[model samples]
Target chain A: MKSLRTFIPIIILLVAWEAAARSGLWSRIVFPSLVNIGREFFLFIVQADAWEQIWTSLYRAFGGFALAAVVGVLLGMLMGRSQLVAGLFDPLFSGTYAVPKLALFPIFIFVFGIGSLSKVALIFLECLYPMVIMTYHGARSVNRVLVWSAENMGATRGEILRRVVIPATTPYIFAAFRVAVPVAMIVVVITEMISSADGLGYLVIYSLSSLRTDRMLAMVVVIALIGYALDKLVVLARDRLIYWEKLDTYYV
Target chain B: MPHAQRLAGAGLLLVILVAWQLAALRGLPSYLLGPLEIARHFAAALGSQELYEHAVASLLRALPGFALGTLLGITLGLAAGIARSFDELLSPLVFLTYPVPKIVMLPVFMLWFGIGDLSKILIIALACFYPTFINAYYGARATPRILVWSARNMGAGEALIFRRVVLPAALPLIFAGLRVSLALSFIVMFATEMINARSGLGHLIREAENGLRFDLMYVSLVSIAILGYAGDRLLRFSRRYFLPWEESHA
Candidate 1:
């Protein structure tokens, strides 16, 4: 019941949208009816090309996200454990952290080509900073007491890392994942919208150009659902794997 | 030790650049310009008035959106955090839609606002809002309850308590949010320009790409990189000045 109350604003917005669509204040092209948008959305789901576009986007996003996760965690862990490594890489990461990596997408297209590879590479680069930074914080702050206790028990370094460090840093990893997933989606969509002939972003641009506002809104809906679903999937996986800590926010 | 480490980092960068330069010396592809060549082209571009015009266009779009978004986001987010009524009305919407990329609304914005800098600026503002709002919300909410109670006991009014206690405590997180939003504003600005624009660095790069002007492309890339890096440094310097007591993350 409480959760249902949280959706009241969204419902109200939807009603206002329907009213606006029907009020004759604007052209049908400007404000497509909700029913028309719903129908287009339904039709979109059944279409093979729509599914392919979604798949293409998902493939790039997940591919880049997965790659960033692996490399970022490793680099972060290394930096956290070794002052030398930290000194070398810390400035490099933080100095460039606020720079929009998307600015390099053009160069990436040249370097990696206009295919999925370039998009994935940009996504990976964009997602890497958050994952690395968050994991570094988490790994560096792992309680020294735990490490000491493990060592006093004659545990090997490998065992200490496995039993204490990884578990302690899991929450931060998930936090980083929460941050990176949206980034992955953003990079993929931006890249597709900028250059690609495929994917949901391209479909949005295509639909708009063709003066099918309803269809474009439908595509936006599809993209939003994918983003929301991906976020929920991350939350679900985090809850299952790192069940000890619940995420405070929807994504974080 | 610090000197050695700095030298090592610089050396690593130099090695990579030198390797690329040597590869270019052997005749690389049309697309891949050497670092030195890129630097030279960037300098040449900087000498021209066109680069300045494009840079100003990009900056105008990004900075105004960033300022507007951060201002609104910090205000609304702080209000929602403190006031139950506002929280009930606003936070649900913000949190629920947080994951959706704001860029997806660019088309709708273009339709509503017209296909000009207005739409692009608004879209960038929308993108910048989420991080600042979320961070500021959490920042304000996370303020120690004891401090608020003590302030109340001292006969401080609501406004006084908020201005003196809550805002100060929340400023760090607000700064964090602003940093994120600044980065996002640039990104959204670039993306909007790339998707549709007659001006800005994104358009310059695209034009260069289509024309096969490798030097122009490299110049644009280097220009953007320098702009991004310089913006970040300026933010850090301001943060240091404003929050002198706060131990910033390196």
Candidate 2:
């Protein structure tokens, strides 16, 4: 019953949308009926081409995300642990944090070619910032007492890092992951939308140009579901691994 | 050793640039220009009025949308976070759709708002809205409960408590959200312009690419980097000024 209360607004919105669609006030193109959209959405799931496009987008997003995860964590940890590294790389990352790396896509196209490579590269650049910055903070602020205790107990440097620093920074790593995953999705979609013949984003643009509003909406739904599911998957993983803490809120 | 390390970093950058320059010197491709040549072209373009006009156009779309979105997000999110009734009415919607790429609504927005700056601005605003709202909500919710209770016990009214206790506590996270929104505003603006636009840095880059003006492409890219960096610095400055007690998070 409590859960139902939370869904009231969503239900009302759907009802309003259906009513508006059925009223004949706007063209079907402007607001496709929910039934038509649902059918198209179902068809989209069953279609091989749609699956391929979805896979293409997923691959690009994950490719970049994985690369960022590896490189960002390493760089972040180095910066956090070494003052010299921090002084050098900190300025670079924080300085350009606000700059939209998307502006380099044209150059990337010229260098990496107008294909999945360019899109993934851009995604990697975009996702790297939050991951690195968040992880740097996490690693840098690991409790000094924990490290001292581990050393006092005759733990080696590697042992201290593996047992203490890693555990301490896990929450922040997960936080960065949450931020980077959505960023990966956004970058992939943006790049594909900007220039691509395949991927879900390209499919969206293609559907729109063909005046297939229902299909476009269905694709949008699919994109949203993918994004939401990826986020849930991250949360599930974090919950299982870092069971000591619960994610009480969404934003880091 | 510190000086040596600094030199090593700078040397690495210099080596990369020299290698690229050397590669271009050997006639790499029509699309690829040397760093020196690109820098020269960017300098030349800076003297022209076209770049300024495009930069202004891009800024007009991004800044206004960023401001509007952050303003609305902070206001609504703070209210919702503080008031249970508002939270019940709005938070579910926000949280459920939080992961959904707000950019997908660009088409629908374009249909409703027309294929002009309005739609672009609104879409950017919509994108910016999520981070700001989420951050502001969390910030307000995370306000020290002890502080609020003490204020209440001291006979502070609700409005006073909110203004004196909640807003200041929430300001840091709100600023963090603003930074994200600012970056997002630029990305969305660039995307919309790239996909379709008469003028802007994104449009400039696309035109330059299509016209085979590699210099212009680099010029637009550098201009965007400067704009983004400057905007971030400005935000950080304001954050420091307003929330002097809080340490820099970004």
Candidate 3:
């Protein structure tokens, strides 16, 4: 019954869209019928080249995201534990936090070349902020008494970090992951749209320019599904990895 | 401790600038401008009409969209937060589509609304909506249950309780969301302009790239960076005005 409620609005939207498509008040280009879009989507998905495009985008997003995750967590942990590092870095991050790193893409294209490397680098740069910021806050705010207790118990620094600090920070790390994953996807699509020979974003642009609105909409749907799935993947991982803590306050 | 720490931070920034200047002296790449070189170019451009034209164009695209999106987001979000039926009807759609890059809708919007500032503004609004809505919803949801009960016990009406208690409680999170949305508005604005615009800093950079006007590129980059930083500072400053009782996030 609860699940059924969720479908009502979506169904209404689809129905309304189909009605508009058939209403004949507008051209077919404006409102491609859903059936046509579905057929185009199916055709696109079945192609071997389509899978390669998907892989290209996925790999680039992941390459940058993985680099960011490792570097950001380590840097964040250091900042959290050491006042010198915190004082040195916090202002830099906060001050530049609102600046759109996307603006750096033109320069990146020159330095990294007009290829996957620059896009990947940009993705890494964008994703790094959330990871570092969240992890720093989490690690800094860890219950001080827990650290004191562990110290009194004669636990080594490494042991204390592993046993207490990491456990406490895992929730934050996962939260950062949730934010960064979509960010990676957003950067990938934007970069590809701006300049790329191949990728889902390029394909969408390609279809539109050719006036294949149905095919273009199909690609949009595919991108949306992939984005939705990636977000779900993060949520699933967070739930599994951080079993002790429910997802954080921001989550529904 | 605070004084020394602040000095150390300043020292680090100074060191970075000097190192970049030295690297340029040693022949940095043609594409990469030195800090001082960029500064000179930006100062020169500051005296020109071109920079102002582009800056105004970009702001025109970004600000209206930001206003429209945030206004709608706050209204709907607050409604959803307080009303269960509204939450059930609306939230699932918002969450499901939240991760989808809203930029993809640009082409569609362009086709529908025409290839003008209107499409760009609408796309920016669409991008800005999610963060504000989610933040506002959560803020409303996080209203203290006891406060609501106490208001009701004291014979406060529903409308009065919402206006006095719920709105105030939600202000901080809504502001946080606004900050996020404001940042997003710039990003989407920049991206859209880069993708297709005759004017704006993004366009200036793209034009400079194609024309190999390295100084122009740096000038545009510097301008946008300053604008972004200034906008953030302005937002933070205004938050204090609106949220006098709340602790500042900074």
The C-alpha RMSD of each candidate to the native structure, in angstroms, is 1.7, 2.1, 1.4
Off by over 4 Å in 1: A246-252, B1-4
Of 2 and 3, which scores higher on TM-score?
A: 3
What's the C-alpha lDDT at position B237 in model 2? 92
Residue-level lDDT of model 1, residues B111-198, one tens digit each, is 9898999999999999989888988888899899999999999999999999989998888888888888888898898899989999
Top candidate by lDDT = 3
- What ordering of candidates by lDDT runs from best to worst? 3, 2, 1
Per-residue CA lDDT of model 3 for A1-252, tens digit only, reads: 999999888889999999999999878998999999999999999999999999999999999999999999999999899889987888788888889999999999999999999999999999999889988988998999999999999999999999999999889888888888888999999999999998988888888899899998998998899999998898888887888776454421
> Least accurate stretch of 10 residues (summed lDDT) in model 1 chain B?
B1-10
With a 3 Å backbone cut-off (N, CA, C), the pairs that clash in candidate 3 are none
TM-score (second chain) of model 1: 0.96
Q: Output the better candidate (2/3) by DockQ.
A: 3
- The reply for model 2, stretches above 4 Å from the true place, is A247-252, B1-28
Which pairs in model 1 have colliding backbones?
Answer: none
DockQ of the two-chain complex in candidate 1: 0.57
Q: Can you list the residue pairs that collide in candidate 2? A: none
